[model samples]
Target chain A: MSSALRIAAVAALLSLAAAPAAQAHRAWLLPGSTVLSGAEPWVTVDGAISNTLFYADHQPMRLDGLKAIGPDGTEVPLQNASTGKYRSTFDVKLAQPGTYKIVTATDMTMASYKIGGETKRWRGAAADVATAIPKDATDVQVSRNVRRIETFVTSGAPSTGALKPTGKGLELEPITHPNDLVASEKGRFRLLLDGKPAAGVEVEVVLGGVRYRAKGPELKIMTGGDGVFEVAWPEAGMYWIEAGVRGAPNGSAPAQNAAYIATVEVLPD
Target chain B: MRILKFSGLALAASGAAASPTVGQAADLTVSVEIPKLNVAEYHRPYVALWIEKPDQTAVRTLAVWYDTKLKANEGATWLKDMRTWWRRAGRSLNLPADGVSGPTKAPGRHVVSFSGGQLAGLAPGDYALSVEAAREVGGREVLRVPFSWPPRGAKTATATGSTELGAVSVTVKP
Candidate 1:
């Protein structure tokens, strides 16, 4: 073959080889182990970059513009803790008690990509009546008032059995408030038939193997009731989802129910 | 003051319940299609399928079809765009699923099936069957279909979404 013909053949081969590499950039956030956990809760967004064939001129694949938010709309900062990894921690010290959420976004290849996960919020209160220890004793004690103490338990479901009486034999009473109520993770859900407020509805919100149950209150409220139903979740992690509905067999609507679901992240205390 | 008290309550409340049923392996079929890339003529995409609750929680990982023939690394980078699946299930598992094929699917259409009993144990409720496709260099698209399993019935349902997939039909074969 002539020299000119050989040059032409080499050019063709080079173009063919680069064809696949020239295609559009495929970028997605890989948060390793998806399940974020800890006693003092936080999240580690770690994952590999797959098929990320970048242009020769551009930098190698890296997580750009990533952020996480807690359930109360607090921003969790992603710290550059190591190579090819990003992390964010939220302390409930300043975060409001409710379902927290984390939104992660990345700007790469001239486009911005985003996704998020939520964690259940369980903010318990220590309002029980306290009893003083011996004058020199360092132990502080409280009388367990059931109603007052119940307010701190996530979901306040009887199954939890986490509620306890104080040394003064004070029982913790359960109160109705939208403090930490996560919806049921079950697929199909229904509310009570009594047209009154949706109380006694069993809601089981499960993420991974963890389950949090929130039961509706017996208090009656209008269809568009403004009352809040809360349940305290056990763990502080990423993304908590609750699913359920309201209706009444005791009212005009029979077999009628509505479904409500929400996602949020629970920050650590 | 309120913060201090609430923290105490939060600690007591973290009781988690039992595991949701890992659906029994019921005979089922899943089809994934990829149109020939307008250019590179690259190999098929590596697709992943899993189940997510209507509430958007990862339930289980059903299948991940990728380019096993080449020993190519199925990078975890692009797994996030498989949004519905990632948040619901994928993020929970360790990498390189053993005993499963990982070769990318060729552009076109592919039909895959699983044995019966896979659908069992999925609590009777609403669920979204999700499938995601990732090309080595091309863009990624995920198609999800909504479905429900009644208390005692074996049936089939079909739904469609805009993405690399054409049509997805899920049948519960008892």
Candidate 2:
């Protein structure tokens, strides 16, 4: 084969490998300490997208979509925010004496279509869909992806003011305060999709230190009829939870797929 | 305090008379020991004591020892340090709950007594007493002692801590 053709073939294979499947690469935000006790303590958080939980061996999760919701349900700025090759680091000053929600959300649409016998793909925000594809494009397929990653850090007593569901995409309505989890007790949480109970959804609970263990300790739980699920922590450590669902396509709109991920720390009793 | 105690007894006597099924009233005494450590700084630990069913549902919060005197109720901010109690019962309670909330204590054995009125309405079943302590610039420890409610006889259960706490004992008198 010609060297140029060989190079083109290799590039094609690399692009195929780069296309990640749903749940292939996991994104997480791990806080240095979920529970704090000072008058005004600062909590550092690391963000990454890796195959292993909490391990920043892969790509960095961009901080552009990151936000910290203070105890008052208002937006708080992240300090010392920096993105390196493998991870993103930021600090949150706990000026308020309550729990804060650190979150990152991405909503986008991807479309593939054939124009004049050539297949092409375009990805951008949902509003750009009209301009992304040509008017004469045939066999056009489009889909929407919405992902949210979040964690909680408490400066003093954990308050629920910042934990109210936004009635947006998938979210966790914590029945048990996230920062107050202990190994000896069970933690309860509710799943909401667009502000409604997301029942009968499968939740993936994985312990964070999977790189050290021979087999990953992952627990599969299904949300009850009330969109509630209970997790009886096996030990004290960090845990990653994820749940996703896909909606059926409406008349002209693409199907919307939503995913939610959270990193929670559980203390030993 | 004496008048309050006398009125409490009067109320209990009247309530018991109104309901024969209300068995003999039982009193619970919890002694929590906050150990002293040789360190550069020593801050009194925030402690919480509560009763839980076998399923770990908090039935009643006996006491919450914290910095109740901070300006503008700032001390209540650190109450999450006692994490288990905060999730189970502390978050719902208003601070300085009459007899349930108080200031932090020094390093020593502090005894807290709860009358039948305090532990009233607990169905006869297996229960556990949990004492959790957290210290600033230090560590956290939680100790639990299992016991049954509506004591068939006088019972005593104890737990020991290593870092943030010392010996903790719960006794019930029939």
Candidate 3:
């Protein structure tokens, strides 16, 4: 199939998967901090598949395209990478603070071949334009569910200038400084659709890795009438705030589910 | 055995790291309840206890109970199941992390304290005491209780799990 045709096919498959009945799960890469101060400061990160965010114990699945970005904007590998029952765990030392981001991608693309009698999931960033449908292939389907998680870290006080959305999907453009968060502190965050405050979206903050609902401490509230949501910090440390909206299948635009996941850090004082 | 020395995470404190003298005298005690489930095969759950600042930076590790008797730290393979702590501070540490790593506890309430190096030089600020438990062929649960450094009066919080653990609690006394 041609590149343009493959792209069209993928869009069609994505729209089919966007039905309200389909499960819209999210994948996230959460870091302990976006900003690291003082001597020998380090941050640990957890990655998993859960639409609720920060709650790794819920449907914890491995994340694809996991990598750390150094202050210089380069891909850095994690040491002692391991997967447990809940999520994949790894740690990175913020030797130079700045804006270190932890990023991960989830494969939401679906490719179904009729002849195989088995549905094969395809990644949006993988080889889509090259492979041809195998012989006896009666039908082929493709869709997109790519999610991105971005966390930041700085040496001193965090800077809002550098912490902007990567324009990939839905994002939480935090009006509140993420690094200087305190336990039980009330914070304000704006849900951004295309660099604007998205309205009436649902947002949640999970205190720890929880597998069951109402098991651990978590706060779930819909974004206020506007796109901004007021979060009462449930007790700092590492927390994931996730919120998103469903972009209806528009003309030529597939039904896209944009999920915004941001790992925020709150300080002790 | 690394012999309970203050290094890496222990010695490395944040800018908030203050002299223990000025930080109110406080004590932290964490208790984990290992549930005894009547299953076909049962193995003790690996548990990790540690404290983190609002930034989720590990301040101190109270305990990491695993199969310490294995030859050449063989039990370390499954340590990652306790995802939160292993990612926050466990990997940087070698087993027999003296004062930290120990053998798994049977179904009972096990307690450990934050004192000596663990208590001293603790910066006064809001922090969370996180306790995580994961058992093989079972479920995983993580409990986090928010408290202040140099604890004032007495602060306590508890989290109960269905499979791997029962009621996990944390208490800090003035």
Colliding residue pairs in candidate 2: none
Worst 10 residues of 2 chain A by lDDT: A14-23
Candidate 3 TM-score, C-alpha based:
0.46
lDDT of 1 at B125: 73
Please rank every candidate by DockQ, starting with the best.
Answer: 2, 3, 1
DockQ of each: 0.02, 0.23, 0.03
Q: Lowest lDDT 10-mer window, candidate 3 chain B?
A: B1-10
Please tell me which predicted candidate would have the highest TM-score against the true structure. Answer: 2
Q: Could you tell me which 10 consecutive residues in candidate 1 chain A have the lowest summed lDDT?
A: A148-157
**C-alpha-based local distance difference test score of model 2:** 0.85
DockQ of candidate 3 relative to the true structure:
0.03
Off by over 4 Å in 3: A1-35, A50-64, A70-77, A80-86, A106-108, A111-142, A209-216, A224-226, A251-253, A267-269, B1-174
Candidate 1 C-alpha error for residue A61, in Å: 21
**What would the per-residue lDDT of candidate 1 be over residues A6-94, giving only the tens digit for each residue?**
98998787556423222222222223222221112233333222232111223223334333444434454555534333222222221
- Model 3 lDDT, residue A22, Cα: 34
Q: How close is candidate 2 to the true structure, as a TM-score?
A: 0.71
In order of listing, the candidates' clash counts read: 79, 0, 11
Error of 2 at A127 (Å): 1.6
- Among all windows of ten consecutive residues in candidate 1 chain B, which has the lowest summed lDDT? B15-24
Docking quality of model 1: it rates as: incorrect
TM-score of chain B of each: 0.66, 0.85, 0.81
lDDT of all the models against the reference?
Answer: 0.39, 0.85, 0.66
Score every model by TM-score. Answer: 0.34, 0.71, 0.46
